[model samples]
Target: MEIRAIDHIELFVEDAEEPAAHLRDGFGFALAGRGGAGTGLRGCESVLLRQGGITLLLTAATSADHRAAEYVRQHGDGVGVIGLLVDDAQAAFAEAVERGAVPVAPPETVGPDGARVVFASVEGFGDVEHRFVSRENRAGPFAPFIEETGCGRGGGGLLKTVDHFAICVPAGTLDATVHHYREVFGLSQTFEERIVVGGQAMDSKVVQSASERFTLTVIEPDTSRDPGQIDAFLAAHDGAGVQHVAFLTDDITTAVRTGGERGVRFLSTPESYYDMLTPRLGQVGVPVDELRELNILADRDHAGVMLQIFTESRHPRGTLFYELIDRRGARTFGSNNIQALYEAVARQQAARPAGLD
Candidate 1:
C-alpha cells in the first residue's frame, strides 16, 4: 500500500457555510463544490474549497445522531477525516484493518458522469478517520458526486499544498500513536524532540511516508506537569484531535501579507529571536528584516532553508489554527522553528486567560 500526498481534509463544523466562507475570503480558497440534504447527502452538508494543491471539505451534520454532529459537539469544529491518496483504496483499507486499525468504512464507489471514485476509511486518533481514496475522475478538484459549483480551484494565492499536520494525542498515548502510523501506514520516525518552555513540556515525534510527501508530527503534553497549550487543546477538544494543518506556500511573504490584509491574524515571534537566527542557520533564504517584519520564523539545515508562519487560533475554542510554510529544499520539519514556536505559544498563553480570547 502506497500513500501519496494528503488527498483532502474534511473538517466537521457546526455550520459548514460559515467556516467555508472564512477560508474562501480570508485564505483565498475558492469554492469548488457543495453537497447537502437535497443532494442525497442525508443529514450532512459539505462545502468544498480548493487552493493550490489543498482542498478542504467543510462538513456539518444536520441531525444530532450524525457522527459529525457528535464530533462537533465534543471537539468544536475539528478535523474528522484525513483523505489519504492511495494507489488502491480497497487494498489500503484491507492492509490497515489487518494491522489492527479500526475500520470506519469499507470500500465503496460513488460516481457521476460514468467516472468512478473508490473510498474506504480507518480510524485514526480520537474521532479522526483516515480515508483511502482513488478516483477515475481525478481531473477536477474533487469527484463529480460533489456537484461542482464552478468556483474552480483556489484564488490563485501563494498558498500551495499541505505541508504537514500537527496531531496532539493524549500524554500517555504518544508512543502507541507513533507505533500505529508505523505499523499501519509503513511510515518511519524521522525526528523526535522533547521541549520545555515555562511550565509546559511536550514530546514530539515526526513520522512520514517513504517519498516524504506526507508528514505527521505527533505531540503529547506532559500529563504530570501544568497544562500547556497541548493540554488545553486535549481538554477543550474533549480528546485527541488535529492541532493544526500546515499549508505550503510558494511565497510566504506574500501569503502572510495577503492573509493579514484579509484580517487574518498570525502568531508573532520576538524580535530578539531574529538576532540569533543567523548564527544557527548561517545565511538563510529570506533576510532577517523581512522575517522580522512579518514575524515569520526561518530555519535551515545542511541542505537549504525554510520559512514558516502560523496563524492565531481561528476557532472559538482555540483548538484550531494553521501554519503557512515555504520549503526551499529544507527536508526536515524546522527544528529551530519548532523551539521558536514553543516560545511563541508560551507568550501567547501568558497574554490570554483560561478561555480562548
Candidate 2:
C-alpha cells in the first residue's frame, strides 16, 4: 500500500494532436512518444509530452465504443486517469479495493522480460480513475507500446514537478470525497478552509501522500448561499472533475514571462490587490512592482512567502485550466489568497459570452 509519486496524468481529448500541440507550443512540452492502433493500443491514439519531471499523455478515441470517446463526450477534454507510482501494483490495487474503493481494472503485466511493468486501476472522483503503476523493471520506455520520437525538449527547466491538483466536486460530496481519499488511499488531510466571497461561499480541503509529493485540493460550492463559478463548473462540466493542475517552479516570474511570450493567457489581478500588498504580507521575496506587472499573486504563511498565478480557461467547456506556483519555503497552500482567487474567477465567469455555457 505504499504509493511513491505521481507517475503521469492521462487526458482524454477529442483530438490528441490539438491539445498535444497546444502544450508543446504554449507550455514548452516536448513530444516524447506516441501510440495507437498500429502499436496494438486498439481504438485510441495517444501522444506523450514531457517537460522536466512532468509527463502528460493525451489520448483520443478512434472508435465509438472506446472509453476515451465516452469520456470526451461526457466531460469534454479533461483528465481521465491519474497514474500513481507504487511499490507493488497488485498489493496497492488489492489494498485499495479492500478499503471500499470501486475496482476499474485488475492488475495486468505487460512488456518484455527485464523491462516489464504492472498496471491496475480503481475508480476515483467522478469519471476520473487512478491507475496504479509499478515500474519495477524500468528498462524500457514508459510503456512497451509507446515509441519514443525524441522531440526537442523545451521549457528551459521552468517547471519542476506537479505541485497539486485542484478538484471541484458537487455541493454535498466534499466531506465524503475527502474521507474516501483518507480511507481508501491512506492520504492525510493536511489543510481545510471555508472561503466566502460576497454572497457566495465554498469549502475546501487538502489531501496529500505521506511523501508529500502528491496533493489534491478538493473544493465544493455552497449551494445554499448563491450559485457561483463552482456551480457553473459543475453544470457545464457535467460532474466532478479536475478544475486545474498547478505546476511548481523555482522562479515564477521567469515562468510567467516565458509562458506569456508563448501565447499563454493568464488571469489578471487588479492593481488594488498590490496596492495593499505591503501592509498585507509585508516585504516579499519578489518585488511588488514585478508581481504587479505579471499579475502574480503573493502570500506569506508561517513558513515563508509563496507566489502564484492562474491561467484563463481556454477549454471549450471552460472547465479546465492551469496554475503556476513558486514556493519559497512555504508549506501550506495560499489560504490568504483564496478570497482573491475566488473573486478573480468570479470576474472571469461574469465576462464570458452569454451563450458560451
Candidate 3:
C-alpha cells in the first residue's frame, strides 16, 4: 500500500457535543462540516473539527442499534476509525484484505463538484477500523457526503498535526499486532524498547510506513511485573484501543503554556530528571530548566533532539488522552521520554483517590 499521511481519525463517543466542544473551545479546532438526519446520515450524528492538518470526526449514536453506540458501550468513548490517505483506496483495501486483513467495508465512491473519492475499511485493533481514503480527482478535509458548516475555530493554534500514536495492546498481542501492520499496511518495525518504571515493565516496538508519514508505537505490559497503567486501560477499555494520540507542534514551549493556561492538566516531571540532563546528553535544543518547568521531557537520537509532554486522561475511565510533541530534525520518538512518561503515569495512578471520577 502506498500510504501518505493520516487523513483523519473518527472517535466514537456517547455524545458528539462534549468532545467536540472540548476540541473546539479548549483546543483550537474549527467545526468544518457535519452529517446527521438532515444530511441523510441515519442513526448517527457526526461533527468534523479541523485544526491545521488535523481533522477529527466525532460521531455519536442516535439509536441503540448503531455501531457507534455498541462500540461506546463496549470500549467507552474511544477511537474506532483511523483514516489513512492513500493513492488508491481500492488497491489498498484489496491488498490488505488479500494479506489477511478482515474486510469491514468495501470501496465506496462518492463525488461532489465532479471530483471523485473512494473509501474502504478493514479490521484493525479489536473493534477499531483502518479506513482507506483516496481523493483521486481532488483532496478535501472531508468526503463529499458531509456538507460544510463553516463553524470557526475557537482559540487553539499552538498544536499542529498528529505526530504518532501509542497503541497499548494485551501482553501477548504486541507481536501479533506489529506483524499485522507489517503484513497488511507494509509498515516496518523500526525500533524496540523495554522500560521498567516504578517496578512495572512494558515492551514497545515502533512501526512506520515507507514514507514515515504514519507511525504506530505498539506497547504491551509485562504480566510478571506490577499491574500498571496498561493493565488499568485494558480493564477500563475492555480491549485493545488507542492509548494516546500525539499531536505534533512547531513550538512545544508555547503549546505547553497554552494548554496549561487553558485548564489542561499534564503530568509533572521530577526535577532530578532535569538535573541529570546536562551530564547525560549535554545542552539540547530546549533549555533543561524551561522543559522541567513545563513538565516536558526531552530525548535525542542520532538524528536530533525532541521535546514532548503528555496530558492526563480526562475521560472518566482514564482510557484516552493526548500528547504534544515537537521534533527538531528528530526522526526517532524519544526513548528516554517513554521511561519518563511511564513514571509520570505511575505517579498519577498512585495518587488518584479510589472511587473518584
Candidate 4:
C-alpha cells in the first residue's frame, strides 16, 4: 500500500471558532473552507485552515445530541479524526473493512462539482480513529458546503506541512496496535524501540507504507517500568487516541525558540540528558548548549540524527498536544526523547494537584 503524507487532522473543539482563530492568528493558517447543514451534520459547524499543505479541521457540535459534542464530552477537546490520503480511496476503505475496520461513512458523492469522496474509520491504537479520505478533484472549494476564504494567515511565519502524527496508546497495547497498522492498512513497521531514560520507559513502533509516506508512531508505556503519562492518558481518555502531533521543521532550534517565545511551552529535558548527548550523538551538527537552551533534544539511530520536543498540553482536558521535530536525515521518531517527555509530563501532573486553586 502506498499511503501519502497526512491528508489532514480533524479536531473536535469546545468552540470551533476559538481554536480556528488561534490557529489563524497564532500560527498563521488560512481558512481553507467551512461546512455544516440540516442533514446528518445538523447543528454542527466545521472550519478548515491550511498552511504548508497541512489542513487543521476544527469542528464543534451545536446541539447536545451532536456526535462532536459527545466526543468532546468523552475525550475533552481533542483529536477526533486523522485523515490519510491514499491513491485509491475505495480500495483502501475496502481493504480496511475486510480486515475488520468499522465503516464510519461509506463512499459517497458530494458537492456540485461532482467530486467523489469515500471515508471510513477503524479503531486505532487508542480511542483514536483513522479516517481514509479519497478525492478526485471533483469539488467546490474542497467540498460542497465549504466556501473558500482568505483564511490562511502566517504564510511567511509557518513551518513546513504536516509530516505525521505520533500517537500514545495504553501500556501493553503497543504490539497489537502495530499489528493493527500492519494488517489493516498494509503498512510495515519502519522503526521499533523500547526507550528508557530517567527511569521512565515506553515502547514505540513506527508504521509506514512501502512508499515511505503516511507514517504514524504508536507509543505505549512499559508497565514493568512504572506508571507514567501514557497510563494516565489511557485512564483519563478511556482508550487509545492521538496524544500529540509532530510538526516538521527545517530548523528546529529556531522553531523551538520562537514557539517558546510565542507562549508555547515545551516539555523540558533534564540537564543530565545533555551530558551524554556528545557520546550518543557525537556526529550531530547542533551544539549541546544550543540544544539545551532551545529545549530541543537530539538523538541518533544508525541512519542519522533527529531533534524533537513536545509542547505542553494546551487543551483543558489534558489531551491533544504538539511536537516540533527537525529530522536531520533520520526517518525515525526520537526514541531517546520519549522518556524525557514522559517524565516531564509526570512531574507536571504531579504538581497539578498542588498548583490547582
Candidate 5:
C-alpha cells in the first residue's frame, strides 16, 4: 500500500469538450490525448489535459447505461476518480479490500512488457473512487485506449503540481473519514483545526502519504452553527465531493496575472485585509502592493511564507473550483488565511440571489 503520488484525476462531466476548452484556454493546460467509441472506448468520450505535473481526464457519457452518466446526473460535473500512483497495483488493491474497502473494479493490465500498466478501483468518499495505478513507462500514453494528440510537450510552466485537495463531508463523518484514510490507505494525520468565522464554524483535518506527495484537507460543517457554503455544496451537489483542487506554482505574481489575462476570475479580498497587512505580518517576500492588486492572501508558519488565491467557480452548481498556491519554503497550508478565504466565500454566497444556492 505504498502510494507514490497522485497519478491523475478523472472528472465526470456532461460534455467533455466544454470544460476541456476552459482548462486549455483559461488555465494553461494543453490537450494531451483523447478516447471515444472510435478508439474502442464504448459508451463514453474522454479528453486528456496536462500541465507540468498535473493530468486531468475529462470523461462524458454518450449512453445512459454508463457510470459517468449517472454520476453527472446526481452530483453534477465533479471529480469521479482520484488516481493514486502505487508501487504495486495488485498488492495495493488486495490490501485495501482486506482492510474493509469496497472494491469497485478488479485489477486490469494492458500494454507490452516495457510499457505495461495496471489499474484497479476502490470506493472513496461518497460517489468518488480511488483508482490504484502502476506503470512501467512514465512517459507513455495515459491509458492503452487514449490516442495521443502530439501536444504532450505543450504544457505551460506556470503550474508545477497538485498541492492538495479540499473536500467537504457531512458534519459527523469527518473523524470517520480521516480514520478510513489512515487505516486503509496508510495515510497519517498531519494537522487538524476548527475554524470559526463569525457564527458559522467547521472542523478540518489534514492527511498525507508517506512521501508527502498526496494530501487531502478533509472538512466538515458544524451542524450546530449557522448554515454556510459547505452546507450549500452538499445540497446542490447532492452529497459530499471535492470542493477545490489546489495547484502549486513558483511565482504568485506572474501566475495570478497570467491566469487573469486568460479569463480566470479569482475571488476578491477586501481592502481592509491589506490595510492591516503592514502591522500584521511584517515584511513579506512579495510586495504588498502586488498582493493587494491580485487580491492574494499570505500566511507565514515556522518554516516560511505561502501566498494563495481562490478562483471564482464558474460551475453551474458552484460546487467545484481551483486554487493557485505559491509556497516559499512553507511546509504548512495557509492556516491564518483560512478565515479570510471563508469570509470571502461567505460574501459571494450572500450576494447571490435568493434561493440560488
Candidate 6:
C-alpha cells in the first residue's frame, strides 16, 4: 500500500461551537464549513477548520443517540477518527480486509457538487478508527457539511501547514502494531528506538509509505516503574488512541515566538540541559548557540538529525496536544527531547489538584 499524506482528523467533541471559537480566536483557524443531513443527523454538525495544508473536522452530537454522542460518553473528548489519504479508497479497503484488518464500514460514496468522495474505515488501535478517503472532482468543501470559509491569515507565525501526528500504544505492543501496519497497509517500519527519559522509558517505531506523507510514530511506555501515562491512555481508551499531533514548520523559532505571543503554552527544557550541549554536539553542523537560545533539542542516529519541541495540552480532556517539529534531513524523532518533555509534563501533572469522585 502506498499511503499518501494525512487527509484530516475528526474529533468527537461535546460542543463544537465553543471549541471551534477557541481555535479561531486562539490558534487562528477559520471555520471552513459544516455538515448534517435529515438522516437523524439534523442537529449534529461537523465544523471544518484549516491551517495551511492541515484540516480538522470537529463534530458535535446534538442528540443522545447519535454515534458521536456515544463516543463522547465512552471516551470523553478525544480524537475518534483519523483519515488517511490514499490513491484509491476502494483498493485500500480491499487490501486491508484481505490482510485481516477488521472492516468498520464498507466503501461508501456521497456526492453533492460535481465532486465525489469515496471513504471507508477500518478498526485501528484502541477505540479509535481510521478512515480511508479518495476525493474526486475536488469540488465543494471537505465533505458536504462544511461551509468552506477561509482560515484567515497566519497568527503567531504558524508554519507551512499541519504535518503528521504521533500516537501512543500499549506497552509491549510496539512490534505487534508495526507488523499490523506492514501486513495491512504495506507500510515499512523505517525507524526504531528505546528512549530513556527522566528515569522513564518508552519504545517507539516510525512507519512510513513511499510518499513520506503518511508517517506515524507509535510509542509505548515501560510500565514496570509506574503506571505511566501511556498505559493510562490505553486503559481509559480501551486500546490505542492518538497521543499528540505534530505540526511542521520551516523555521521553528518564528513559530515558537509567534505561538508564544499568541499565548500557546510550550513545554520548557531545563536550563541545566544546556550545559551538556558543548559535549553532545561536538562538531555537529547545527549552531549550538542558536539551538540553546531557542531551547530546541536535537539528536541523531545513523539516518540523520531531528529537532522537536512539544506544547502543553490545552484541552481539559488531557488527551490531545501538539508537537512543533523541524525535521531537516532526519527521519527519526528527536530522542534527546524525550526526557526533557517527560519531566516538563510530569511537573504539569503534579501541579494539578488530585482526587476525583
lDDT of 4 by residue, 1-357 (tens): 457757778898889998788776646577787877733357788998887667788889888887678888888888888888776777787888898777776665555444655565665654556777667652224555566675542355447866667777777678888888889888988777777765567778888877665778888888887666777777667677888877778888877776666666777888988888898679588889898887678888777889888877766657678887787888777766666776787666666654331
The candidate, 3 or 6, that scores higher on TM-score is 3
Model 5 error, position 147 (Å): 0.5
* Tens-digit lDDT track of model 1 for 1-357: 788878899999999988888898889998888888766687898898888778899889988898899999888998999999887899999999998999999999777654678899999888999999987756553764478878655457677898899999988999999999999989999989887776778899999998777889999999777788788788878889899999988899999999899888899888789889888677776788988999998877766888889888868777788999898988767766766787777676677766564
Question: What would the TM-scores of all predictions be?
Answer: 0.94, 0.96, 0.94, 0.88, 0.97, 0.88
Q: Per model, state how many residue pairs clash.
A: 0, 0, 1, 15, 0, 10
Best by TM-score: 5
Candidate 5 ranges with C-alpha deviation above 4 Å: 153-155, 353-356
* Global lDDT scores for all candidate models: 0.85, 0.90, 0.85, 0.74, 0.90, 0.74
Off by over 4 Å in 2: 138-140, 151-156
**Cα deviation of 30, candidate 2, in Å:** 0.9
Please, what are the lDDT tens digits per residue for candidate 6 over residues 285-334? Answer: 55777667766777765666667778777665556777887767776677
lDDT of 6 at 28: 60
Ranked by TM-score, the better of candidates 2 and 4 is 2
Summarize candidate 5's per-residue lDDT along 118-210 as a digit string, tens digits: 999999999999999999987777887888787663356798889999999998999999999999999999999988878888899999999
Give lDDT tens digits, candidate 2, residues 239-305. Answer: 9999999999999999999999999989988888999999999988888999999999998988999
Give the lDDT ranking, best first: 5, 2, 3, 1, 6, 4
lDDT (C-alpha) at residue 134 in model 1? 85
Give the true-structure RMSD of model 6: 3.0
Which residues of candidate 6, in runs, are more than 4 Å off? Answer: 37-43, 138-140, 150-157, 235-238, 282-294, 301-304
Deviation (Å) of 126 in candidate 4: 3.7
